[model samples]
Target: MLIDTYGRVATDLRVSLTDRCNLRCTYCMPEEGLSWLAKPDLLTDEEIVRLVRVAVTALGVTEVRFTGGEPLLRPGLVGIVQECAALEPRPQLSLTTNGIGLGRTAAALKEAGLDRVNVSLDTLRPEVFKTLTRRDRHQDVLAGLAAAHEAGLTPVKVNSVLMPGHNADEAPDLLAWAVAHDYELRFIEQMPLDAQHGWKREGMITAGDILASLRTRFTLTEEAGERGSAPAERWLVDGGPHRVGVIGSVTRPFCAACDRTRLTADGQIRTCLFASEETDLRAALRSGAPDEELARIWRQAMWGKKAGSGLDDPSFLQPQRPMSAIGG
Candidate 1:
């Protein structure tokens, strides 16, 4: 079941369709985006499906999520989703997106077998959104979220990064807006994945800081449930119905139970989001490798996964690629 050296079973696979994004988020990538992979270098839709099939049938993968600098940027995304759905014992499928382009493509994506989506929306204010992402597409994100909900993409999730001076004050307001909109909200403590190499701990907001502010308005009861491989720690808000999540990657680590792996658009396998290196599978894929061989490469990679993501290590180094390039 693709168990790692530390007995962590790998069931969730995040595949990057492309490293090209529309917006340049401050916490994700540099204002001037990095050089993107050429068309030939990016894995084809057929290659992606073949790998998913191997992960599902051979390596015991049960959930597959398509990510990207922006997955919707890929023209073949729906087709890829369709092929993955056609797999026997089809895995749970989902996507992570910036939500700018989702307004026009939400229904098409749902029809193509995408189960749900997690949209990145940092702020409700248009000016703040522009300042954070270097793009004035806040309206587009709002419209896309509405379209996703309208398309029956149940429990549409909104992911916000907690940067202190930037959008920290909006924490309570964001939660209230999410509750009113009936969308799940997640506050992700900013990790060391930015392209600027300026992720100082002092400038970031912790999960405790957010919850403490939230406590002033509503009662948050931690949900004593199985977190499994999911990154976010869930909570029941005020009462039963509405809930909120906080991904305390920095302050409260959940590395021991990490059950996820990532594949870059160019086909490199990353066991952790903050990994220093990645195993290149694109070379083998282009060399006419078979399914079993690909499976072996994946297994070899997972077998070497460290006990944790190593964020706490004094020698911990940031990944060469930015968070956007590495996928969600």
Candidate 2:
């Protein structure tokens, strides 16, 4: 069950298909970009599928989310989704993408057995989007979101990171846009995950700020229920089924309920986003380790999961790898 010493079982797995992305969001990477992994270092389609099979069939993972610097950039993505869907007790499949190329691929991915998608879109204004992403693809993202919806990716989620002095003022407008389009909106507090290592607690927006900004335009009622292992704190928008979510990874860490284990594009297992070390599965896979051995290694890796992200600790150091390399 991949149960940790803390008694938290990891039933959700995040797999990074590639560390490559099309848009260079300022919060994620420098405009010039960081050095990307070489092609050989990334797990092949077969390797990725095998690991996912083991996670579901052996380790009991019920949810598998494919993430990337931009998952849409992975050429074999549709095929990968198809293979993962064929697993016995088939896990719910989803993808996290920047949404640039999604406009063209959403339908194909949905047909390939992808259950849904979460697209990153920070601002409604094209100029703000351009400044934040260092790319002129705002329209592309909107089109992509529409395509995902058209593809019947129900409850399409939009992930927004509020950067102070940038698109912070657009919270209400973003929510309004999301609601109008039937896209579930989630505002995530920026963490120290950028490749540039420039994030500061004071500079990033908080969950409080997002709610306050939202209240100015709409009434939000705290949705009645335990949040479970989901990171987002959901609020019923305008008092109904429509809602907005805030993932305060910095201010309101939900590590206590975390049920996710991450697999890097290179096959390293990361138990926490801020983890200083990674467990090497690539080496084991390449060296002809059997399935049981692979599952044992994974179980051992997750058993050492940290109690919390330690962002509050005075000595906390940002992880060496950026969000792009680690997968969101």
Candidate 3:
């Protein structure tokens, strides 16, 4: 295991396949997105598989997740999943997508060894969806969710970002919809990862506000279980087995238990989502660095990992790269 100085073992690795996205979401970035990484600069499919192999074989990584500006936008996604699944003591594989392109590829992805998926859908209303995503593809997302579920991606999780004065009143509707469709729902407090650097903590929704709304519609009891390094705090809804998760990064920091790291599409390794800087793995990869050396570099990066991103610290500042570029 790659244990940080803080004693947190990194068992999960998030690899960004690409930074290109099909949608221009209001919450994700400004109407006009930033310049993307050149295709020649991004990691090839073979290079990505080799990196995953090292993490699973040389390190104690047990789970591998694919993230992107939108993961499905990557052409070799299925092949990536297949390569990861072929490893000895294979790591569990999952993906987080915006779901615009998922309907066409979910079954193929599942057939290739994907274990689960988390789709980002903020609102169910078509008008709200268009306003939020700057795209008229809410129905496409809905289709993709159904396709993922039908492909046996059990408990397909829906990741929604709660923004004040926007889609906040849809909590009850979102919950009821999740209950009816059997998809686990998680409402995340908006974080300061936007490409525009426009996130204001005061305007962002908090965990307390989310629970209060849930209480009005259904009962919520905090789950009495270990949180480990997982970001979401699980809770049982209305005394049923159905679970609802809340991620309060701004109000309730979980950096102390964050046993995860990220690799950018361009091959930079980031120990934290809000890290001020990243380690350039692409330089090593292009310089004929072996798996052992690559592993060593990863370890060295984590060795300096901080306890967490101190959002409340007076010196706190957003990363130069937006969330899309950072592979969150």
Candidate 4:
């Protein structure tokens, strides 16, 4: 197993298939669509599969998640999922999508061996959705969730960014909806990663506040289980199969247990989501480098991983690259 300097195991890998997205989420991208990575720089499906093999076989990676500006935008996503599922000691394969195009691809994705999905839905109101995502396709996202459920993608998760003035009031409603549908709902506190938009601390809705508000409506029982590297704290409502999770990355950073690393669409390996530094793997792959050499490069990159990110640092300085480019 490749343990970083922080003693964090490299167990989870989130690979971005593309930097292109269909929606312009206010928290992710700028109003004027941001410039995308050059097509030539993005890793091919073959390269992605090869890296996954190295991550699992050589680095002890047990879980692999496909992310992107929108992973479904990648033409060969199904093929990638198939290859990942076919690994010798097959890792748990999952995906994070905006759900704009999942309506038509859900069944195909499940057949291709995708184990689960997390759909981004910030609001249930159509106008609020349009204002948040700059796209009037809330109905499509809802349809995508139903389609995913129909396709046998068990435990479908809905991820909502709880922005203070934006979708804060809809928290209980979202949780109630998730409980009714038996879908795992996660309300994430907004981070300062979107520096391009001049994010302020006041704009954030703390996890404490959310839980306090939720406790008034639902009897939340603390979940006694092995938690993942994610910052989300899990809670089981009174009588529901679906659990509610609050990802307090901003107010409560789980940096010590951060076992996941990200690979950008252009093949740069990021040790942390809030990291500004990255190691480029595309250059090595394009130069006809051997697998051993590639692995060595990855090792070097992992070895240099920092103990914790600067998200909570008083001197925290946001990187020029937006959250989309970082594969958040």
Candidate 5:
């Protein structure tokens, strides 16, 4: 088992399949998406599987999450899922999607052994959705959620980024809807990943503020016995199986319990979400380096893991890359 210098186990890995996304959400991508990684530069399906194998078998990784600019957009996503499912001690396999193309791909994903899904949705109102995403596919996302439920992906998780003045007012309504549908709802604090794209500290909404607002509407009971590397502070609403989670990566960072590492679409290993430097694993992998040498490289990289992201530190400079590039 590989443990970083900070004492966090390397148990979960988020692999970004591509840097390209269909929607240009203000927080994630620029109005015009940045120049994308060249086709040959992105890790192929086979390379992704090999990396997953290394992470799980050698590094004690127990959970594998496929992320993206929208993982479903990748052509060989189902095949990749199939390969991940065949691992010896099969890790808990999941995917995070924008739910745009899920209507056509959810069934195939489930058939290929995906265990769960988390969909990114901010508002229930169509116009607000369009204003937020710059796309008029609100109905399509709703349809995709329904399709996922029909395909037996029960209690699908919905991820909502709470942005002040934009969708913060919708928290109560969103939680109520989640309770009705028996889906887990998570409220994420907006981070400063793309500061140039209008991410200001003043424009941010904290997790505490969100919880306080929700408490006014429903009596929230803290969930006990929650486990693993989950960053969310889980709570249960009165008389519902619906769990409300707050991912306070910004206002209340979870750098202490961060057990996850990320692999960019091009095979760079990022130890932290806010990390500016990345270890070039693709170059080493493609160069026919021996397994022991690759393991040594991984070890060296993990040793250099920073103590914390220090997001609130005034000295912190926003990463030059966008969230899409880093697989947030």
Candidate 6:
């Protein structure tokens, strides 16, 4: 097990299939975008499966989520999912995407063993979407969501990041939409993960702000239960049956129960989202290191994980790699 001194064992793995994204959301990167990782630098399909195999077979990861600048953009995604699904103790597979190409790929992905999807959609208005994303693909996202539902991706999740001036007021409407469509909605407080490093605590929306906005339209009762390692704080919308989630990653940090380990597209292990250090597994994998050696390096890296993401500390510095590179 990848157990830290804090006694937290990692059972969830986030794998970044690529660092390249189709949409340049204002909060994620510049309009021109950041430098893309070279093809050779990225892990091949076999390499990715091998690392995942090690994590599941050796390190005890049970849930595998594929994220990226936009995972749907990966040409070999379906094949990769198929391979990962074939592991001995097959891990639950999911994808986090911007939902650009999902309309065309959702069914294929579901067939390839992808259990479900969490799409990033901030607003229902096309104009606001364009303004925030600097792209005119709002309808594409909605279509993708519908397609995902049609493909039987049960409990399709929508991840919304509330930026203060941009669509922060849409909380209630977003929730209403989710309830109507039966999509589980989660509102995440914007973190200091932007490429430009322009995030300010005062300017970013908080979980409190989201609840305040939501309470105006709906009665939310805190769901009874320990959140375990889940990042979202769930609330029963209105009376029962449906719920909304708030991930206050900054203000209500859940690092104490964090069970996630991240693997970059290039095969670097990131013990934390805000980690300043990354352990390289690619070099060793390419240099003929045995699977046991690879697992040992991974265990050592997780053992050294910081107690928490120091977002609340005065000395906290934004990670050098932005959210795009870090795999959200």
User: Per-residue lDDT of 1-328 in model 5, one digit per residue for the tens?
Assistant: 6578778777889999998888878787777737998999999898899988888887788999999888888999999999999998999899888998889988988999999889999999999889888899999888888778878776699999876667878889999998887778999988877635567777678898899989989989888884456889889898546689999887877777788888999999888888889999899889998666666777678778888887888878787767887886
Please state the error at residue 89 of candidate 3 in Å: 1.5
Which pairs of residues clash in candidate 1, taking residues 3 or more apart in a chain or in different chains? none
Could you tell me the TM-score of candidate 5? Answer: 0.96
Higher-scoring candidate on TM-score, 1 or 6: 6
lDDT of each model, Cα atoms only?
0.89, 0.93, 0.89, 0.86, 0.85, 0.94
Name the runs in model 2 displaced over 4 angstroms. none
| Sliding window of 10 residues with minimal summed lDDT for model 2 | 199-208
Q: Which is the winner by lDDT between candidate 4 and candidate 6?
A: 6
TM per candidate:
0.98, 0.99, 0.98, 0.97, 0.96, 0.99
Q: After superposition, how far is residue 269 of candidate 4 from its true place, in Å?
A: 0.6
Better of 5 and 6 by lDDT: 6
Worst 10 residues of 1 by lDDT: 27-36
- What range of 10 consecutive residues in model 3 has the weakest lDDT sum? 25-34
Say which prediction, candidate 3 or candidate 6, comes out ahead on lDDT: 6
Find the 10 residues in a row with the least total lDDT in model 6: 160-169
- Residues forming the 10-long window of minimal summed lDDT in candidate 5: 194-203
Give the CA lDDT, 0 to 100, for residue 175 in model 5. 94
- 2 versus 3: better lDDT goes to: 2
**Which portions of model 5 show Cα errors greater than 4 Å?**
195-197, 226-228
